[model samples]
Target: MLRLKSLGIVSLICLVAACENSGANYQPVIDGPVGPNYDIDLAQCQSLAARQGAFDSTTGASAGTGALAAGGTTAVLNNKGTNVRDAAIVGAVAGIAAGAVQQQQNKAAIVRNCMRSRGYNVVG
Candidate 1:
């Protein structure tokens, strides 16, 4: 009951964060003149980045860890912590949200690195 509510709140937060990140347009900063293949290279790199999905096995593991930690902490703090399940749900949601943000960052890095490997002076 309470756990479900907490999970709902956490889910909402993660949803909002994901939406914000997705709406952002990422552009690599070039240090010099653009080559003729610049567009092609960029398109390829972006395609690669797009293929990088947000959730992975690590994300699932993190959620489990969060659940365990939250449940344990809640139990310890309140003895009969009726809210243990709720806390666990919230922790798992937080972990999932963190994972999502991390993946977004990873995608950006991939694009930058791909450009750099192609001999573009990506300053950003």
Candidate 2:
């Protein structure tokens, strides 16, 4: 339905905007010519990102649980825009959106920290 789609679009935009704000002003140092040192440093930063992201397992699980719980609650509400199919779609969207935001935030933090530590001014 148009209403459902619009709700989803709004929710998605709000969610993405919120996440984008987490690193909105950040400008990473990816300038200069590519070379071996850049590649090695980038790889190290990626490794650090992986480690930093690992801390999000619990957060991810909690987000999943919350989305599912909210979805179920919406269905039980049985009010407008709370039908079963719509509830499921909302739940899936919420879970995926939240997970994606968390990952992006983590990666941004990792890269910012890494670059900053390497004497690059990462402003956020």
Candidate 2, 17-61: lDDT as tens digits:
565534423346654554557656656776666554322565556
lDDT of 1 by residue, 65-117 (tens): 88899888998897666688778887887777766776677778888899999
TM-score of 1: 0.80
Return the TM-score for candidate 2, rounded to 2 decimals: 0.48
TM-score against native, each model:
0.80, 0.48
lDDT of 1 at 32: 96
